[model samples]
Target: MNLKNKIVIITGAGSGIGAATAKLFGTHGAVVVASDINLNNAQKIAGDITEAGGIASAIKTDVTQYQEVEALIANTIEKHDRLDVIVNNAGIGGKEQLKTAEHTHDDWHNVIAVNQTGVFYCMKVALQHMMRQGHGNIVNVASLAGLKASGHNLSYSASKFAVVGMTKSAALEYARKNIRINAVCPGFTHSALLDQLLAVSPDMGEKLKRFIPMGRFGEADEIAEAICWLASENSKFITGQTITLDGGTSL
Candidate 1:
């Protein structure tokens, strides 16, 4: 994919699929803006890209905060002169394995804030700049739960389902303006978020793996590849679509 000189902003880029996508985009000649809740981790990823002879910068952003999200876009535009693409990859999982009745209000609101509302904030800000530019791309990191009923976590599922809906609605609204919006629904991927779950239930990984026909957990890089494609012109005709990379588990 030809992403040369494309200014791309990736949220939650400190680790997991976000970090992997930053590195991949850098290698493909995109100027990567790595944004995360943790400044240190974002700096490390940005530094790694720079060390590899690619251009990148780090910004600390809490996507759950609209002001912070606004600053992230404004600062990127101020430095780069134009915004090309935004990967709404920042997200959080709620209390896992909890029944609907067992899920707390705080957990639901917190998950919705980061996963759903946060995406809206990023999209809202980026859309303004992108609309003026008359061209842009938006790649949202949703989850398998978003595409189907995942009894794992009520709040997480609800929030992600909202992402899917938002992506499609926004894509149709912006298609004529030369902007594309899409999402990726990854299933059973090995990410820091998943590691946290494993920390709590060590055998969960093996149990989840058994459901996948591939019999292995996905690597972050695997998901990154798809994100890079969606951000590139290679997928110019594709929008309002959720690409699933679950190793046949969804089947």
Candidate 2:
């Protein structure tokens, strides 16, 4: 599906899945607004997109902060005049050293603040604009752990699970208003952060792969493709659902 002229905003566009999605969308002819907590990283991605002859801009935003998120959306609209799509992808893996029972309140709140609450905050403000225009699409980047138990990574899993829950509710709420909302569940995608996680336990990586019938870790591009499809007219009939790019690991 073509998204020529569409105005899209992608959080966490500095790296990983978000970065991949922004480039793909820009190449597909969408005007992408890349937002990330890291200004340098966001600017680099925007530069790459521009060099490739795509329309893009970088916005440094801390998704967890309401004021920052509000300003991010406001600035996008001020620049483009309208917003057609929003991908809430900014997130973290949460405190690594802490188990469920050992997690500090600060760590737990921090993960939820960014991963779950941030998605909701974005949707709330995005829909305000979308509802005004009477058309829009939203895609939340959740994780496979949202669908099932992901022992040891309690806060991240919990936040993602909340994202899935919120997406379903929001999707139904806006469907009649001519807006579609969905969630993407990706499994063990390779990212710059993967090496650090894998170092914790080499066996965990192997264990994750074995769960996937494809016998390999998925890539960020793989997940980005699904995000694009859901955002485009190709999947107009789909809503209140999640597209899993887990390589059959969820099977």
* TM-score list, all predictions: 0.98, 0.97
Candidate with best lDDT: 1
Tens digits of per-residue lDDT, candidate 2, 37-110, equal: 99999999999999999999999999888899899999999999999999999998765756778877876889
Candidate 2 Cα errors over 4 Å, as ranges: none
Q: For residues 115-190, what per-residue lDDT tens digits would candidate 1 score against the true structure?
A: 9999999999999999999899999999998988888589999999999999999999999999999999999889
Give the alpha-carbon lDDT of every model. 0.95, 0.91
Shift of residue 84 alpha carbon in model 2, Å: 0.2
Please state the error at residue 53 of candidate 2 in Å. Answer: 0.6
- Candidate 1: count the clashes: 0
